[model samples]
Target: MRQPLFVTALAATAIALAAAANLPEPSADIKAAVAASTRTPANLARDQYRHPAETLSFFGVKPTDTVVEIWPGGGWYTEILAPLTKGKGTYYAASPWPDGNKGVQNKQTADAATYGHVKFAAFPWAEGQPKVPDGTADVVLTFRNVHNWRMGYQRGGTDYSGEAFAQMFAMLKPGGTLGIVDHRLPESASDDREKSSGYIKVSTIRRLAEAAGFEFVGASEINANAKDTADWPKGVWTLPPSLSQKDVDREKYVAIGESDRMTLRFRKPR
Candidate 1:
């Protein structure tokens, strides 16, 4: 009787192990690329807002999927993605530096060399439509960049942000995923706060994406910062990096760290 019970328990453990093994793992090449890039101890200490392995997994990034990163500023995430998709999958960075912004263009050029298979596509924020092919990308990722569109930062008069969301939906294949991460403001917060604080109410973001014909899947609090009271006079930049109030409230700002972020996942209608 004891032997029979032990055998059953062993079989259950085997089944669990099998399931775990089937789970997707991040590429080692990607990890090495990130390690070799501009990511440093000081950068991690201040701009270490990334949620590591989980963020990639949530986006359903695999070694076999074509991925496009939108507005890959300074190639921060691009460093990890370019090599991951090398050889097996295509990794494309859309949008060159705007108006001869050499600082950003130089960064992209330096980072592009790390992977031989990587490609670049121009993404200009003009009045017309985006040029990304329809139903082409398996994943489209934009980080901390949506508010600019909402506030017409890219260009005046046109709400290119909503148009950008629609373009992403068009660029993704059926059942493909859209991953977004942005600074989060309180739900009760007003539009004035969004313009001033560099943070947007989560509901507004969700509404805009849904309006673009994508399905609202879910969100994660992996990057939540509890210390932020959401009442900094200078807004999100009042925290680290920007530290808008450097002289007046340096100590208070340093203690809060980065702004609270909202991580959201949306899916193109299949």
Candidate 2:
């Protein structure tokens, strides 16, 4: 009877340990950062659709990792990232400098007040200069900037996607991560449409990264939106926020909300 009881106790302990190993930990700090008052209500409202917490988790972001955000347009993610990485980690806004872009200037100013120490790295898009140093970043992230790079490629014949991706790869340490979130176009969409439409195929992006010497880690549906048909009148701009149509089926576009996006992760080989 005593031996049987001992065996049962051991089995229970083993099961408990297994469960604890698999249980998801609370991202309490990240949640608190997102809820911080520094973030505007309009940016906060998009949390339901953006799923920032889950998306960051999928990208394997750590509090102490050195992160570089490529073209942080309007600093939507910057608000969350700046606070989260305030103490230990470094946050670099790798964007165009000396271009007199209001959005970039506004973001840098807001970031200083919000984080106290946000580093700005200049990316000369036209000159194709490498903004970030080699083997420094733990993660390099870009959101909705690929189409713009493609345009630069078309206009300058510099293979902007290839050059930019190689620079990103060079900026990371071995085994470091590259996280990308961009508007997704259907697989059936023509490659040429990427210039006009604010969308790119997943396969095309994967190839770009692979060519730059990064391995495909995985992809997440955290940013996917079923409502997006990818064939809007003014492209992705037809969605909310932009609403380029302006009062033409305004309510209908509002119902559809933001464009569907692809969340992808890649890794530098160790």
Model 2 lDDT per residue over 28-64, tens place: 5565555566777678767656767666766778878
User: Against the unseen true structure, what C-alpha lDDT does each candidate score?
Assistant: 0.69, 0.77
The parts of candidate 2 lying over 4 Å away from their true place are 1-26, 100-113, 124-130, 153-159
1-270 per-residue lDDT for model 1 (tens digits): 123343334334433433454423434543343344344344334324565444676567776789988877666676567657767788877763344224345655665555556666656434453445778999988888888777677576345677778778878998998999888888986777776567888888898889989898887776678888778887777888788877887987887778888888899988
Best by TM-score: 2
TM-scores across all candidates? 0.79, 0.84
RMSD of 2: 10.3
